[model samples]
Target: MVHEPRSQTGLSRNSDTEEIVALAELDPESWSAILAPRLAYFAAVARAEHVTRAAHQLQAPQSTVSRALVRLERDLGVDLFARHGRTVSLTAAGRTFLATVERALGEVERAAESVRADADPESGKVAFGFLHTMGSETVPSLIREFRADHPRVRFTLVQNYGEWMLEHLRSGELDLCLTSPVPDAPDLVARRLDEQRLRLVVPEDHRLATRKRIRLAEAADETFIMLEPGYGLRRITDDLCAEAGFRPRIAFEGEEAETLRGLVAVGLGVALLPPPAVPRKGVVELTVTGQRAVREIGVAWLKDHPDTPPVAAFKRFLLTRKGRLLSFSPAGV
Candidate 1:
């Protein structure tokens, strides 16, 4: 027989307090199921500040909108709106709740849009990653040819070394990647697209610059500017050097192949690199003889991950270009 205190809006203050606490404890599924629809109606009404106008905007009957608002306030244990004839104004509580509700609704709308975009065949997005060496020409040509038929498809391109691209693929940040040495991981699916010949690049004035080809062992005494460890190209360089019966004298370590090539051009050191997209001045590229000095370039993705339409289409297009992936002119080489 205890009488609860009442608020100015005629709501039972004690019961409203208990209800607010209980609402906070609801499980995610229960909260979402019970409150999502009510929140939409509340937002519509809050924006218009009039039930009749909000109902028209929502294309719902005015009675339905009023009932939803009443139910929402009752469930939350507070009066969210102050009624004055046919017009309504937000209570302080309503104003606070509206800010959070709007953000949640916006996130939900964006999520819907993202999923719909992924499912679209003609205009979906693909998150693709690739080696830095391929960015200048190889990737551009591949994308241009693929987009000939998929003109509306969008791409999110990332250029990084092989191992970093693989990490992004595992984390779901990348849908597909073109990487070197054709990674042999259990969690990844890979196909050898082509092999790029590695060349020994030195300054134009260096002793071996005039030779078109030489055994890798010939540069054993030369200071080498190599990519830092963890890059697939660096690993290939190390292994190839080891096979040639000499460890390269390390002069400098860098991130990008082109940057290392630039260092070689400046006479800092020599480096083993892929053929440049355009012939660079001040450096002579010599083919490595007596040892297989080529890195396998392959397309890779998570083994069991499902691809969106655009990603799947691009993957298929890439597989079709198996031996011809690079498309570099012999003159450029």
Candidate 2:
């Protein structure tokens, strides 16, 4: 697109026309072919501060490095360096341009590494991230079951909270993740594997220990042991308490669900938690009656990412286990 400069009378200037024509002739691809190698040359020269030493470091001739830098300055319309005898120093413009060039080089290197990693189908790796709660049982079971088929497939597992895990998924650090209260994002492909019911656990000798089923509001006055603020369980706890028409009085906050269970076992405070795979001693699990007392666990991956062999296999294995959730799953969510 060309914009002809116009005066108040709408007459075009000849000087502006010539400038636009010259600008139009500057093809970006051709210029980049000329600029890319020069950027490397500039970086080397900036580092060494001496043309001869910079050329030696790059294993190139001194004349070649010097000529490239001169042409680069001409093309960019900036004074990149000031030479005093054999020593060189970067101009203000040179420092700013080097910062951008370094970032561009890093991105290129990462792209190349990713492409090479993707090309290897044999003995490939899957970066599988998941929730801390699922790491103990659900995740392990899924991996073991999946690996039975693809024995050579490797895994890099990460355990993190709900939204945090999704960040890893988007960045391509994780091929897939299992998270609770599945995150809603336009860029993510999420499938609800199943919903696992969370039970209200109390110490064996507590007043509500004998009750197999109870309403959440019934224990409004009790001090609740909750996961810290960012956790998916904590969000569910707050929502469930809100549904019950009261805010829980938090007695303790911790990172892991098992730690919260431990706190409950000693009578420190009662907690609303997922039923442990093997019920921890000294704590009794009870069903919460009103509203749903379940968290929806699901797998998520970036919609734009091309799945590797291991990632695709693992994902298919997970989908097959849709209705077959963990051992503690109740009749309904």
Candidate 3:
């Protein structure tokens, strides 16, 4: 099968167009020469079709503009303009090449603007990742407190499982994450955030609903409603059950913790869950008395990643608010 070269508009550019594109890639030094001189002079002349007018708009001399266009053509090994007396017009090759160079220059401008935004002290952005479980109350409360002081600071919030969030942290897509099992990667700097107590949630008519506190062994036979596997909370539930000498027989598995709580409320099965900020109706929270009935949550970021002002401010804010939640960090930091 024969494959033809395609341009930005998805149209076949034939041999000459392919040569133009290849020149930009095969000889990067030449491409860099075109870039190092800045494409503004070429772009102005291309847009106006007159070197003298382009020089006037640029406040540069006509000779300088002419020299720049000649240099750009010479470096790229393509004729970008056809001159007739004082004015110039784009050739077939010139139109195709200009299309590529305009887009490249536009991206360079956008990149500059984005870096400037990231560097601005008062109004920069932070890409924050946290567990789906923390999205309802814990994360919002913290963000509200932080925004009270830095009102213009922006956030890009991502909520996912610990494993997925950690991947984003490593890829530089996320500045920081609130996650559990506090991944032990050498590339990450993880600070113990808080440890949440897990409660054994029983339906209203279940055999053990009347009990205030029960060791996990008592529910050895009960079916469990739990978050799906690969979740940090699910790992804790499974570990707690294992320590109690039983593997959980799952009744229902779901993405949301509240949905699992709702299933328990309807008497589908009992679940091991963290207490809701507001207790859900029709379910009773039983304290799980055991050694492994808690999950560790921590803040992790790529090691040596320099934080922008907003990211630094929010990290400090999170570190300082130690007593706001019922949970406490094992290391207290």
Each model's TM-score?
Answer: 0.80, 0.67, 0.79
Q: What ranges in model 2 sit over 4 Å off?
A: 1-115, 327-333
Model 3 residue 319 distance off true place after TM-score fit, in angstroms: 1.6
In terms of lDDT, model 3 sits at: 0.80
lDDT winner between 1 and 2, please give it.
Answer: 1
- Tens digits of lDDT, candidate 3, 190-255: 887677778899988888989999999999899999888899888888888999999989989998
The residue pairs found clashing in candidate 3 are none
Model 1 bad stretches (over 4 Å) = 1-37, 44-75, 82-90, 329-333
Model 1 TM-score? Answer: 0.80
- Summing lDDT over every window of 10 consecutive residues in candidate 1, give the lowest-scoring window: 6-15
| Ranking, lDDT, top scorer first | 1, 2, 3
Compose the digit string of candidate 2's lDDT tens values, residues 160-238. Answer: 8888888888877888888988878899999998887889999999999999999999999999999999898899989
What is the alpha-carbon lDDT for the whole of candidate 1? 0.88
Candidate ranking under TM-score, highest first, comes to: 1, 3, 2
lDDT of 2: 0.82
Query: Which candidate number would show the highest lDDT if scored against the true structure?
Result: 1
- Score residue 321 of candidate 2 by CA lDDT: 85
Which is superior by TM-score, 2 or 3? 3
